[model samples]
Target: MSQILKGGCYCGGTTYTIAIPDKLPQVVGTPHKVPTSILDHCGKCRKTSGSLFQAWIVVPKPWITITYKYKEGSGGKLVEFQSSAHGTRSFCGACGTNLFYDSSKKKAMVEDMDGVVYLVNVTIGSLDEESLTHVELVKPKLHVWWDHGIGWIKEAFTTAGQGFGGLAKYPTGDVRQSPEELI
Candidate 1:
């Protein structure tokens, strides 16, 4: 069955819905494939979110709908920042909350996806807190950029501080999908 996951900025200035297909596409570039989501610890993600790690839900561009509203005499719209040569970031101008990470400039991990489309990743934290109760549903299969991660923070997570679950860790990127699956 399909689902439309709801999320928005902290100030309620921006809102969006993710149309979850019956089968989530391999929208995230892999060696980590079919996660439909991931926990990002890359430097870019850290700087943008001002957090140690950022959780993201990945889906095709066609699957997401974004709306902007004006509030408090402010634009109250999503401001786009070209954070990287291959990626663009969007956040609420009113409250400065990072919401969307656009990877259209980057190439899909699997070359043979059948058609041209880009992945639009959303900040999982922005999703309704109630929807996050089901851990497995939003759990990331891989932790990317581990080498750049802080040690104590990593240990706190890996050594069973509390509510810990083991996920594959990759220092640089992630485990790629099988060669056959690429086509």
Candidate 2:
């Protein structure tokens, strides 16, 4: 059988399925290992998710398929917001469930691949609970915008051993510095 991951919005108005690539690593004792998962604590992500940090699973756009269960007399469509100049965030129009984040430009290049590949960062929270049998695989590998994160959240990431050096730092003075300034 083909390996597939299924998920949907809170109200079930939006659903999706992802075809697991064979190239993805497999944990010996776990069902899967998401090699491209990361945690973002950027101001924009915090405001958008209303959380201290947002866990995201990055995958090629071609691997995912989305479906919308529109309400009676409502058009079946997912709402999208240009979160930044280079990225767009999508959500369920009916229930306002945040679903996806797509970059306007292809950010990475695959040497073996023929053409550019666009990546879509999906919120792990939107995934179906049952579909995440190997929940360990979804653990954030790295923390981005760590400097912008609250002191407690940054400490949590450090305790978890997922904090990236340089970017992750204890809050000292002003915490509103842009990520570019930190770099």
Candidate 3:
């Protein structure tokens, strides 16, 4: 129950089953709690993903294992990209499906309790919605690299209909408490 998690890419050409320990290793676990972000990557993500942003859940690399085939091309050949300083960007080169980023080899000076190399980020858009909904594994609480985010996105997520100013984090426990009272 603790080690198995599943997900895949947009076209299903690339699928992944990862093995994540209950206690993730250091580099992987470090970013999980402090508002790990979903980056629209200023418009780059829109162009690359052809969507709003590069939606991903950053987790511990060692906690994750590449369990399935990550292939590209019409022939189902191996597709990979030497992208980013942190890791490899893999996908179905045939369809250009953004599959996964393997960041385990990326150097992190910090040591983790699990003592494993970490891969870190996974695209949330590629995962199974039914599974994601139950776990809440990838709902982004904060948006980063927004200075370059889509123009309308800020307006959409930040629309002030209920007198909410759209700060990054929201308060907890009370729904009816007046803003003034809570503060």
TM-score of 2: 0.75
RMSD of 2: 10.8
Sort by TM-score, top down from the best: 1, 2, 3
Candidate 3 residue-wise lDDT at 24: 41
**Candidate 1 lDDT by residue in tens digits, 85-154:** 7789998989888898997574464333556667777888988776666465577766768888877778
Per-residue lDDT of 87-182 in model 2, one digit per residue for the tens? 899888877888898987834443333456676889989988876775645666777788888997677556755555446453577778766676
lDDT of 3 at 25: 39
| Total backbone collisions for each predicted model | 2, 0, 11
lDDT for model 3 = 0.57
Candidate 2 clashing pairs?
none
TM-score each candidate.
0.75, 0.75, 0.63
Mark the 10 consecutive residues where model 3 has the least summed lDDT.
28-37
Candidate models: Cα lDDT each: 0.74, 0.74, 0.57
Using TM-score as the yardstick, the better of models 1 and 3 is 1
Q: What's the CA error at residue 50 for candidate 1, in Å?
A: 0.8
